[model samples]
Target: MKISRRFAGLAALLVAGLLGTTVHIVTTAESADAAQTSLRAADPSVLRVGGTYVGVQSVGDNGIAVRQASSPAGLATAAARTVFTDSQRLGEVWAPEIHYDGGRYYIYFTMGAGANHRMYVISSATADSGYGGATKLNLPDDRWAIDGTMFVFNGQRYFVWSGWAGTTNVEQNLYIAKMTSPTTATGSRAVISQPRESWERVVGNPFINEAPEAIKDPNGQLHVTYSANGSWSEQYCIADLRLRAGGDPMYVWDWYKSNGCLFGSNRSTMMAGWDPTLYVNGPGHHSFVLLNGDINTSPPAGSSFPLMFHAVAKGTPYAWSNRYWYTGSFMWWGAITYSRANVPGSTTNTGYSIKFFE
Candidate 1:
């Protein structure tokens, strides 16, 4: 049986404790969305460094956990082993993202409870295999931060994450700052995007804008997709921010918020597709591996992008513990607009559309 090489990379890594037959993402919509595995882990991030595949997650309240695979296909069977847990057990350690650059691997995550939350990083020569002690990332103002992710744009490295503006537990806004090094962020943080759209302000205690992920398209548009609304609400979904042309990356006015969530609750009718999961809600806090064939590692032609996120199963009576890991095969249609019922004029090249695989 011929299987997709791109889909194979994420299939194994997400199935940690479950058993499943080999499957691909190119099948009918029914099989695609039905092919989910309940990893029961939050804030999943997977990175392929050379031939090694490493995944980091907030498996527990104390610290970061890791699972590795020697091959992309081996990710399906790799077992999770906690690499870092707070000895002091300070607060809920959530949204740990693993990134690689300059021959070193870095894992950035949040530590401490509520207002005391701060972004921290730990690195090893390898990908968290020999991870050392955690070092608090030095951000300007040292505000409460979480879900720190790093990306290099225009030959300079930059850091982005969800953080509070002041000392209060007010709204969480998406912020960008220049990173002098992977472990430290330099320059003042720029509040690029926040909860402004009506859909973004849906279920709010403090109006959310957390879990910022950076992706750059072929057009040089630095796209930052963040989660909006309350994390536990069924309205918990993914939204976008694109750095406009001739715009400075660090400037707040340079970024334009997209019209809607890339993928929202099935009840909201964001993207058009068959509902294979019975009830799928809160698809946010994701990590994406784009098989663009130029950077990182080259792949065969027709390789697709993989977006993995945690989502709650049912909408009514939203429960935090009910969230599980799910992945979508991201397709790029270039200049063609996706002809979906609800998402008219949506282009898969920009707007979000995915085919779940079983």
Candidate 2:
């Protein structure tokens, strides 16, 4: 019954190839209930414009598939259309994120057939059209990089990504640098996070901490969420690091890791309503977006921030094909408690809760 992690990934891929379908069967009503509670599935990176929502997913050889709709419900049913493709990039394009800045939309993605992965960017005039050719992002060094995302803080634009410390592939860490422009880096890169914690060092790989996504809470504190562990294992999960409002982002000492993972595989049996078989598996590689309004009205209002990340079915083979989008709102109570309610611009003493679909 002992299976090697490498073999497990291979076996999952082989099964996927033979089955010719990505969907897995749910054997029980409890599993079905879990699926229903989960967000609509996709390999999603989502953005909302006015009333319309747009998303992009990794499509292997066909390139990044873009989907759009007026509502999240409609977006679930919308057919994907190929938006950006480079015949020269002879491999998979991974984790494409769409962002709007300076009167244009930009997409940051990872592309490579194998070990030589690098972060690339493309520009578009609108939210979902006129995308320009891809260009390699100007990093401080040209080692290996991926999962690049951008954010603005204190009126300065910055880019954050997962990259190798050197030419070697032994370790992957999260780095941030000031951006001279949307597609270029201006200064030295800061190594924000590495796989230093036991929880971050998953079984298959001791050196991982990739897929960085940035979010600014209402209090103006900066939070960066990144995926940890081997991407191919059920242990893959999301963790967070935080910086206070006036903290220096370039200073490594200014940021603090969350007490524990923000989301991931579950082993606990405390929840009476949760079937252990239906627990979320490998939930990481995520992006965050704020909803225009509350989706739940029963509590008068709910948090608008929802996390879009990929997860696999419990007990399923850990193949890339098995990864599907699942989103849930974040509970800020843990963050507040961890920060001792010192989060900026907050006058309340209440904790926040995530509103999952019923």
Candidate achieving the largest lDDT: 1
Compose the digit string of candidate 2's lDDT tens values, residues 1-358. 4333234334544654675524221111111122212334434677766667777776656387677876443455677777788678657788888876766778888888556788888888776678878898888877688888887777788898888888777778999999978888887999888787666764544478888877654455677778887888877767677775577888766676654455666433111111122356777776565432111111112323344567786777877767667644443322233232343443232222111221
Each prediction's TM-score versus the true structure: 0.79, 0.76
Clashes by residue pair, model 2: none
Lowest lDDT 10-residue stretch of candidate 2: 23-32
Model 1 Cα lDDT, one tens digit per residue, 1-358: 4344344345433442244322232222212343335477677787665456677777667877777776333444578777887987788888888887777778889999879899988888865478878898988889999888888877788998898899997788988899888887887899987786777887887999999878764445576778888997777887667665456888876666655666676445353322223446777887774332112231113444555677776644567787776755443212212221332222233332233332
lDDT values for all models: 0.67, 0.63
What TM-score would you give candidate 1 relative to the actual structure? 0.79
| Backbone N/Cα/C clashes per model | 7, 0
After superposing candidate 1, which stretches have Cα over 4 Å from the reference? 1-34, 70-77, 266-279, 290-302, 314-317, 333-358
User: What lDDT does candidate 2 reach at residue 153?
Assistant: 75
